[model samples]
Target chain A: MSGNILEVSGLTKTVGGGKKIVDGLSFDMKKGEILGLLGPNGAGKTTTIRMIVGLMSKTDGSVTINGRDLDEQGKACRANIGAIVENPTFYEYMSGYKNLKLWGRMAGGSVTEERISEVVSLVKLEDAIKDKVKKYSLGMKQRLGVAQAILHRPSLLILDEPTNGLDPKGIRELRDYLRELADEGISTLVSSHLLSEMQLMCDRVVIMEKGKVIDISDLSSLNAYGDKDQVAVSISVKKGQGEAAKTAVSVLEEVTVASHETENELLLDMGRDRIPELNRVLVKAGIDVFGIESKRTSLEEKFLQLTSGKADKEAN
Target chain B: MFALLHNEWSKLWNKKQPWIFIGILIVISIGTAFLYTAFDTLEGAGTEGDGENWEVTLELENEQYAQTIAESDDEWEREFAQDRIEENEALLAAGVDPNETNNAVFLNEMIYVGTAFITLFAVILASTIVSSEQDKGTLKHLFVRPYERWQFLVAKFITVILFAAVMLVTVTAVQYLMGTIMFGTGSFSTPVVEYGMGGVITTTVAEVFPQKIGLYFLNMLMFVVISFSISILFKSQTLAVGIGIFILFGTNILQGFAPLLQDYFWYPYVFLPHMTLQSYVVTDEFIPGVGLGFSLAVLAVYAVLFLGAATAFFQKRDLV
Candidate 1:
């Protein structure tokens, strides 16, 4: 990652009734990076994003986007950003093209008709662009939201659950589209509670719990805790072979073996360097070895461990 | 700013609400024309004798009293005086006579009444222009755009004024055509201004031209500012419209008796003598020696203050 494109420090928002929804939250997103904000309900992710976009005022703290203070130069700062704060409300009575055209004007660029048509095609809404937005399906609306956010080619894009209501196919399309955007050097921040999807899309993830940032880590770092560094070797053996397998496993130092009577087998977890030693020990012990395999940790296991395990519970 | 203006302009022209308002105005025009036409035909030859006509009853009472004064017998004189007193009482019970004297006067009165109805549309239209976005949650989408808050508000304000102007002209045109065809294209009977002995002055009904333009434009502007201020204050279209209509009507009624509060400390500021555009139209008293110029200046100040507050509040508001 390059230098940070968006930095929020000590952000707090105490709503009207004296409740602090977001307190002391801080995070940094680097250039051309895709950061996912993962949180449960009432975790203050939306509130923090609103404040950053200048839609909701911060109770105390600062937000800088592309090195410009959000408060000091709000217009200048927001000019470089585009956000889809929630479900992306649009003028429902207006046609899709008209809605984008109106917002594209407000986005303030050299937004030509050609550029608008290009965006329409980019979102894959070319056939339906002339239809009123009220008639659009939820998936279509989601795409339209993406189209509007990226219309001006803003450097920093913020989406709150951009795929909140999409089906399987739409979600995959959105994933690819977001990846393409990041590849084009646009920094994006996407918020979602879909952990697996986030793991797949984000270069890094920031998980919040109860109004604070609980963890911020790259995908590799999150994997470190749950990854499998040992290789497994399964060997077929004769009936009444438990004692023999145990003796055989004992020969390979630092190998842990467990026997299953029903299958008449031994399962071994050993380091890559010890695989040959285990084979020699098994052969010396006169046990027939079937196969050896290595399995890496899946993202689902890493996500659950990172989000639900004691490491985060204790940190929070 | 220009882009915001263009967006607002398109919303105003293409929305269903403005067309609905225009449709309402059309219905009102047709209704007013029918009501006035029926009244004119019934009072055929301008005899002013229809029992339903309140102004006619007052005129008859005055004539009866003149005849009663010419009698000589004491009992007869007393009896005639009692008859005259009874007639006067009957006339008063019919309520204040609306000034529908002739076709010209009636048309002018219709314009005044139409102004009130049109004010409702202006207030609601302007308030909704800003507050509806907030209510519908569309404002968040708008706020995240590059446009400044003040520019957005100004564009909304301009759209409201243009909407109000179109409604005003449509109603005025319909009334003008009906009034001309029915009233024989007569020159205005009342003078623009009248001067009594020793430079004492009296206003009349004839000066409705430029003064009508002034009153309608000024009142429209005032209503726009008022609606916009309330819209920003409440951030709700329904409340803004309701409160605006109540204040518009309430202030007029209160100002009718405002001269009674001349001894109070707050009379000058509460002096809302502006509903009677005819008083301004006829007497040149709207500004007295200074004329319409002074009246316009005072109105401008109110407009600026309210619109400025709207700008300030909108800019500072958290887009919920």
Candidate 2:
């Protein structure tokens, strides 16, 4: 209730007679926070989620949920967690309402009819709740999956690639619902390869590579790492002054010209405080400055750089 | 555990499989009764011209079997002739028509036919209980619940057993209705002769009918445990069912070969030799040294071993 809602330390999983699929991975999630697990193919994101949810056994280390150890007090720990590993599977032949009832009873709490109805509406599936799951669209199924997981209102919710087959609108709706859930104090751990979606959905992210935690940072702070004092700025100049503008920005002592958007516009890497200094320097050199704007690196770019082995250079 | 079992039961009841199986049993039950009635009517019509009473027919069959016993040099032939002669003598003295279509005969034949169908349905149920969840990828959902792995498994185990019981009761009820409507409840107190390992036994239809049904249920349990265990170990519904049905039918073939291998030390321990609980129910013995107690004990051991293995494997296995 006070500390982290979920904490995983030194978790390791080995398969095929000693092939370590997940090695020494550790992270934590605070209450009401949305944590994203990002990794490339075969980076063990699913394996880590599976181990945490007890779908797959861990070879070593421990998982503590709601201050209860998973190995020592599994039932107590698991009682606080609701998870859907990979694609959510359901009894497709049954109605979505029945599926919820089935899991609701198994969820080990007083799941009333009102609660089931509330969750059904929460996932926006009220119109289709009585329909067979086999008739549901992929996005509807994903929402139903979320409904099932949160039926008991567990302290921590884990979803592994919950948006695997969702369309754009469905993904947006899911992201919005997850944020709404987080605001209600349900800590969530989501594993997804969709960096853009993770950026929009997650509060903090743990980036993994080859079964190891490569990086963990706030979504806003990911671009701030290694460039804490510098900001990417783009300056627009008069139509034919692009070269002169680039030359003028290159000559500035505080700024490093990064690229040119056009013959008249130039991009620079400089401190936010020094942006005015460069603008003044360019204006004083008889340059026609149209506008200057600071640009931040996108999460997709940062993700590619980190996973492509440029993390060390970028972090430094 | 109760909640888990309740959930399992609900899921099973919600599916169309059990209902479909029930429908199949009903159709087969009514169909068998109608077919038997038709065949009985046809035979009675054809045999009326012979002018031979039921007693005269039995006497003639007994004389023929006695002559065969006297002339036959083969041991098995002599034994078969002697048993038939004794059966005829008993029927003749009891004034019971062997060809009569009565409620007792209906129930008895229904039990025999129903056991085969019930075994088939039970095998299908047990084999798919675990493996279908795995195949559908719904097992991970169950595993993530607060219940222990064995609780889910044991729930499924109990559900399959319950399903078999339900099927047995249903078949019996349908057969009873059909028999009452068609055969007028033909005196449940009437006597019937049953062949068993200890030779032959005579008992009232009321007593023997329930015992036969109970023995069939026990036989189903024996197969259910094995099939359920196979489902857990292999995680393949097809394999579990295939092997289950193979064992079900294969035991009959093995029974034929059993007499030849009766001298082997492991013959009694082999499951096929004891698959038929009818032998124990009738004569209280299946083989020379194997009695009711011994057969039930062996089956109990196999059941325990199967369930233990299923629990152990499911507990440790990763739900991939």
Clashes of 1: 3
Interface RMSD of each candidate, angstroms, one decimal:
1.3, 1.0
Instruction: Please give, for residues A159-178, the per-residue lDDT of candidate 2 as tens digits.
Output: 99988889999999989888
Model 1: what TM-score? 0.78
As a whole number from 0 to 100, the lDDT of residue B256 in candidate 2 is: 92
Write candidate 1's Cα lDDT for B1-320 as tens digits. 88999999886766788888888887787678778878767765455555477566666666776666665457777676766555455435434333234445555557755666788889888779887787667888888887677888888888888878888888877777677766545446542222222232233346554566667777667766887888888888888888778778876787667657545654434325453443555455533343455556666676778778778877787775
lDDT minimum window of 10 residues, candidate 1 chain A: A220-229
What's model 1's overall lDDT?
0.74
Q: Note the Cα lDDT for every prediction shown.
A: 0.74, 0.85
Cα lDDT of model 1 by residue, A18-111, tens digit:
8889989999999999998887667788888888888888999889988888989888878878788878787888888989989888876567
**Residue A257 lDDT, candidate 2, scale 0-100:** 78
How does residue B53 of candidate 1 score in lDDT?
A: 79
lDDT of 1 at B306: 78
